[model samples]
Target: MRAPLRSRPGPGAGHHQVLFFIAECVPFAIALVVLTIELTPAHVVYTGPLLVATPALAAVTMGPKGTLAALGVAVVVSVITATHNDAWGGQQVYTNLVALFLVGAASVVTSRAVQTRRESELNQVRRIAAAAQEVLLRPVPARLGPVRAASMYLAAETGAQIGGDLYDAVQTRYGVRMIVGDVRGKGLPAVRAAAVVLGAFREAVHYEDDLVEVISHCGEALRRDAALAGAGAAGDDAFREAFVTAVVAQIQEDATVELINRGHPPPLVIGEGSARCLTPAVPLPPLGLEEFIGGPPGRLESYPFAPGDRLLLHTDGVIEARDGDNTFFDLARAMEAMRGRTRQAFLEDLRDALLEHTKGSLADDVALIVVDRVDRSDPVRGR
Candidate 1:
C-alpha cells in the first residue's frame, strides 16, 4: 500500500536550526575543558587554535548569525582565560584580544561572502531549470485544430521551476491529444519521470494510431527503461504510484472529445454558464501501472464540445493544496468564479484563486491545461 502524503517542515529551516544548535554548544564545551585543566601557561598555547577555530567553524558550518555568536563566545573565553592566568596586566592580553577580534571579523566577512556566492550559484541553477522546463513543456498554441487554449504551471515550492506534476498537448493525425499527470516523488527524480512520460507521449502521439495504443506505447517505453537500468521493481512501483492517477483525451474532428481516466481527478468541462465533471465509466489503471493485459479497451465517452466550450485538465496539486489551517481550497468555488469568463480570464482567476488559497505557499506543484474551442466561422485562426 502507498503511504499517505503529509506536509512536513521545510528542510532548509530544519538544517539551519541544527547547525545553529551545534555552533552554540561548541563554546560551552571548550569552556568546560578549559576549567578542567589547571590554569597553566601551557594552556594559553592551546587556546590560540581554539580561538581561531571557533569563528572559522561557525562561518563554514552556519551563516552570519552563527559566526557572530561564535565570535562573542570566543571573546568571553579569551577574557576568562586571560584573567585566570593573571595575563590581563601584560601586553600579551591586548595582543591576544586583538588577534581574536580579527579572527571573528574575518569569519563574519567570510560567512557573508560564502552565502552570497551560494545564492548566486543557486539562482543560476534555477534559471537554467526554468529554461529547460519551458523547452520541455513548451507553450501550447492558443488553437489546436478547433480548440482555443491557455495553461498555467505553478511550482508549490518557492524557487522551483518544475516538479512532479506535468501536462502536455499536441495536434496529431488522430486528433488533438492531451495528457495531465503527476509523478509520485519530487525533485530531480520526479522531473526525470515527468520527462520520460512526456517524451514518450510526444513520440507516440504522432506515430500511434489509437489513444489506447499511445498510452500502451508510453507504458512500454517506461518499462523498457526501467528494466535496462536494473530499476525494474522500483521504477515500476514509482511510475505506478506517481501516475497512478491521470487523464488522457483526444479531441475528434467532429468537435467531440473522447477521454480515459486512470484513478485521476475528473476534468471539468465549462459551457453555457456552469461547469460539470467529465467522469469516466469503467476507469482504467494509470498508464504506467498496467501490470497485466486486460480485456479489450473500453469504449471512449463522447461529449459535444461546441464553439466557445472550454475543458480544463489539472493535477491534484490544485484541489489538494492546503493553507496554514490545513484546509483544502474550494476548487468548485474557484471554478464557479471562472464561469462566463474568457479562456485567458478563466486561467487568471484560477491562478489568483490558488495563490489566495495557499497564501502564496503551496505544498504541491500545480500543472493545468485549458482547451477552448473556437467558433468555426471565426476568421481569427490563432488567438
Candidate 2:
C-alpha cells in the first residue's frame, strides 16, 4: 500500500522562520546588552563602535525600516548611557552621536539602493526565463488530433523555469507525435542539448514518416551539437559523455500507440479502471551513445490505446523523488488515486501530490505529459 500524500507545510518552513526571527532580533538584542553593561559599574571604555554597527546589522535582515528603528534605539541608548556616566557634554560623546547618525543614514541609503538593484535584477531574470520557456518548451495543445494533451514542467533549481527535462507534442502528417526526454547533465549545457533535440524533433516529425527516423534525427542533432560545443570549449568532457534518455510516442487515428523508449521510464496507460506500463521490448542506449548498442535503434512497440484512455509520459524525476524517510514516490499509485479527475486538474493535483511527498524539495527537474484519447465525434473536448 502506498502512503497518502500529506498536504502539510514544507519541512524547512518553520526552521527557516525561526532563524529569520532570530536574525531580525540580533541588532536590538545587542543594543540591550550594551545598555545593560553601560548602566553597570564595569566602566566599559568605548561602546561607540558597537552602537554604530547596529543599524548596519539591522539593514541586512530588516532592510531600511528596521535600520532606522535600530538607529533610533542606538541613539536613545547612547544618550542614556552618556548621561548616566556623566560624560554628557564631552567631545567624545558628541563625536559618537554624530558618527551614529552618519552610519545610520548611510546604512539606510545603501540598503534601499541594494534592494532596488536586486529587485530589478530579479525582474530581468523572470523576463528572460519566461522567454526561454516559451521558446524551449512549446506548449502542448489541448487537442492534438485524436488525443487531448497537457504538459507540466518543474525545474529542479531555484529561479529556473526549464532545465534538462524536455517534452513536446506535434500533429504531423502521420499522426500525433510526442517526445519526452532528459539530458544527461544540467544547467546551460543541458538546455542547449534539449533545444537541439526539440528543434530536430519538430522539424523531423513533419517529414519523417517513421517514428524511428524522427528519433534518429534527434540523435544526429545532439551529436552535431555536442561536437560543436566540444570544439569551442576545449578539453570539456561533458559533451563527449553527453547522452539523453528519451521516449517518442505516436498516436494514430486507429487509437493505436507506438513507443520507442531509449533508457527512460516506461510510459503508463490508464484505462477505465486499470493501468499498466508500456515497457520497451528491446531497451536501447540513450541518444549520443548509439555506438554502444551494436545494432540498429530499437523498433517501435505498439499498444492498444482505446478512446477515453489516458497516457502518461514523464522523466525519471517523477519516480526518483524521496520523502523524509527516504522512500521513493509511487507514480503508478498516484495516477491510480487521481484517476477520475479532469485532464488539467489531474495534472495539477499530481504536481501537488509530488510536492507534498517530497516536502517541496525535488532533486531533479520533472517533465510530464498526460494525453487522453478522445473520439472525434465526442461533443465534449479537453478543457
Candidate 3:
C-alpha cells in the first residue's frame, strides 16, 4: 500500500523551476545590454544565437507554458537588440530581424523534438520494466489449495522494477509449497540468480519427492548458472561471491507446516492471541553455499499450523530497514502491534510501517507473504 515518493513528470517540481527561468533570462539580458552600449561593435549578431539554446534546456525542466513564455521573452529581447543596433538602415534591420526569428523558430523546433525523443525513451523503459516484472514474479494466487494467501512486493530500487528479492507459492502434491529468497548483489546479476531459484522451484516442486530434493534442484540450477557465467574471467565471481538466502515451506492438508530454511529471515506463526518467530535450531548455510555443510540436507523444521493460524514470511529488507537513528526495523515488535488484525490487514499495515520507518526510501528490495490457515470445519466460514 505504501510506495516510494517519485518525482512528478512535466516541469521541474514547484518553486524549484523559478530558478531555471531566472537563469535562462541572464544571457538575453547580457546580450541586450551589450547592444545598448554607445561604443558597441558593429558586428554583434553572435550574441543573438546564444538565446536559442535556452529553450532546449527549458524543454526538459519546464512545462509547455513555461517553455513558451521563455521563448517569447527570447524573441522580444532579440528583436529589441537588433532594432537598436540597426536603427537607421531599414534593409539591414529587416535582415537581422529575419535571422533572429529564423533562429528562434529553430530553437522551438529543437526543444519539441528533444521532448518527443525523451518521452519515447521513457515509455519504452516502462514497458520493458513491466514485462520483466511479470515474467520474473507472476501474480500469486489468492487461494492455493485450502490456504488463503495475500502477498506484497516492494522493490527498493527507484528505476528497477525487479530486484534481488523474490517470493512464489505453488500447490504441489507435497502441499502448498512456498519460497521467499534474496539473491546477493544487485541489478542484472541478482535478477539472474533470483530467476534460477524460482525457475527451479516451479519446475521441480511437483516432481521432487522430498523437500530437501527440491532444495537440491535449486542448488543445481545455481551451479548451472555459475558454469554458464564462468565462461568469462570475472564469471566465477558470481559463483563464489553470489548466493541466495531462502526459506522453503510446505503447508500440508492437515494444517501442518514444514520448513527448510537456509540462513534466511525466520517465518512468523501468528495465531489468535500469540505471535512466535520460527528460528532454526541448527541453521544451515545458504542454498548455494552447500559446501559449508558438506553433507545431506538439514532436517526440516516442523510447526503446528492449526486453523486460524497465519504464517508470515519475508526477506531481510523488512528487518534491515533503518530509521533516522540508525535503528533497524523490528519485525517482531511491528507484528505485536498488529495483535487483533487479519492476515491481509497485517501485511498492509506492515508495509505502511516499513515505509514510514525508512522515511519513504529503501536501500534494499522487499518481498513478503501472509498465508492464513482456513477453518473449514466452522460453518460460518465459507471456503
Candidate 4:
C-alpha cells in the first residue's frame, strides 16, 4: 500500500509570520542606527524607503488598525529626521514625506485587495470541491429496503474531501447492489478512473442482472475512458499499470449477500457479538487487468446475511494506515471491539480509530460502507 500524503496546518502563514517578525525588527533597527549615528540627510536618506516598507509589510500580517499604526510611526519618524537635518521646511522633506505617505497607503490598499480576492477564490474552490464530491460519491440512503446503511470517505490529499476511492449503493429490481473500489494511483488520473468505475456501476446496476456482468460493464467503461485519454492528458503508461481493485456485492431480500472480489480487501461480517471475514475462497484479479489472467477469475462467494448482521466493505487505506512506529492498523481487532455497534456508530468509531492510529492523517484514499440487515423486532431499532 502506498503511504498517504500527510497534511500540515498554516504552512504559508508560518512562513509569513517569520518574515513579518524579522521585517519588524530590521526597520526599527535601521531607524535607531540613523537616529544615533547619522545626522546628515544624505547619510539617512536611505531610511525613508525602509520606514515606508515596514508598514506595507505589516499590512499583510496585520489589520487596517495595525497597518495604520505602522504608518503613523513611519510618518512621525520621517518628520523627526527631517527636523533634525534642518531640512523640515525644504522641498526635500515635502517630497520625502509625501512619497512615504503615498507608498504606505498604497501598500495597505493593495494588501486588503489581495486578501479579499484570495478569500473569494478559496470560497469558490471549496464550493466546486463540494459539488464534485457529491457527484462522485453520491450519498447513500439511510435505508435501502430492509437494510440500514452508512458510508464514509477519507481523502489523503490536503484539503481534498474526495479522492480515487469511491463507494455507491442503490436498490434495483434484482436486489440492493453496492461497489467499493480504489484506483491504482492518486490525483486527477486516479480520480478520472474512479469516476469511470462509479458511473459504470451506477448505470449497470439497473440493467445487469448478474454481478459478474456488472463488473464487466465497469471494466469496459474504464477501458473506453482510458482509450479516449490515449496519448492525451493521461498516457498509455498510466493506463498500462492503472487498474481498479474492487468488490461488488448483491444483497438479496432473503438476507444473503453475494460478493465478487477483484483484488480488493475482503469484507467483514459482524453478527451475534462476533465478527468474521467474508473473503472469496478464490483469488481474483483486479478490474481492467483481467486480460492478464491466464484462466478464469474468482468465483462468486455467498454468505448468509441474517437480521442484525452488519457488513463492512472498505478500501486499502484503512488497513494500510500506519502509525508513528510504522505499524499497520489492525482492522480485525477494531471489528472485534465494535462487533455490536450500530451501523452509523461503527463507521464513526472506525474512522476515529483509523485517524488515531495514523495520527490524524491517512497514507492513502479510504472509502468505507456499512450495511446493516434490519431486524424489525429488535428492541433498540424498534423505538
Q: Write the per-residue lDDT of candidate 1 for residues 1-383, one digit (tens) a residue.
A: 01112233433867877877876677557655654452664574556556656777778766888789878877777778777877778886687678878888998999999999999999999789868878776767777777777777777654566778778889887889998888777766677677887888889889887787776666667666555545455545544344435678899768678887766788887778677888887777765667643876545678767776778898888889887889998776788777777666677778777777777666777778888877656765433
* Per-residue C-alpha lDDT of model 2 across residues 1-383, encoded as one tens digit per residue: 01123233333656887999999999899899889889998656567888989999988887788889999999999989998999976898899889999999999998898888889999999899789889898679888889888888877676677788999999988999999999998677788888888999999999999899999999999998888877776645666567899999999999789999889999999998767999988989999988888788779999999998999999998999999999999999999999878878888888888998899878788888999998988855646
What local lDDT does model 4 show for residue 214?
91
For every candidate, C-alpha RMSD to the true structure in Å: 5.5, 4.7, 5.1, 5.0
Write one digit per residue (lDDT tens) for candidate 4, span 1-383.
11233543322656876877886565456556655543654564455566667677667666566667777777777777777777666776687678778877887787678778888999999899788888988768887776778888777767776778989999999889999999998767788889999999999999888888898889889888777777465355575457999999998878689999989999988877667888778887888887876765555778989987888999998899899999999998898898777766777788888888988866787888888898655434521
lDDT of 3 by residue, 1-383 (tens): 22343312222334656777776666445545544552256544355445565554455555455466656766676566656655545565566456655655665676677778889999999899788878888757778776877777888766667788888988888789999999988767788899999999899899987888898789779878887787767855754467899999988878678999988999998777667899988888887888898666787888989888878899999999998999999888888788657656777788888888988777688888888888655443222
Q: After superposition on all CA atoms, how large is the RMSD of candidate 3?
A: 5.1
The pairs that clash in candidate 4 are 4-363
Each model's TM-score? 0.80, 0.86, 0.80, 0.80
Worst 10 residues of 2 by lDDT: 1-10
State each model's CA lDDT, in order: 0.73, 0.87, 0.75, 0.79
User: What overall lDDT, based on C-alpha atoms, would model 4 receive against the true structure?
Assistant: 0.79
Best by lDDT: 2
Q: Distance from true position, residue 13, model 4, in Å? A: 12
Instruction: Point out the higher-scoring one by lDDT: 1 or 3.
Output: 3
Best by TM-score: 2
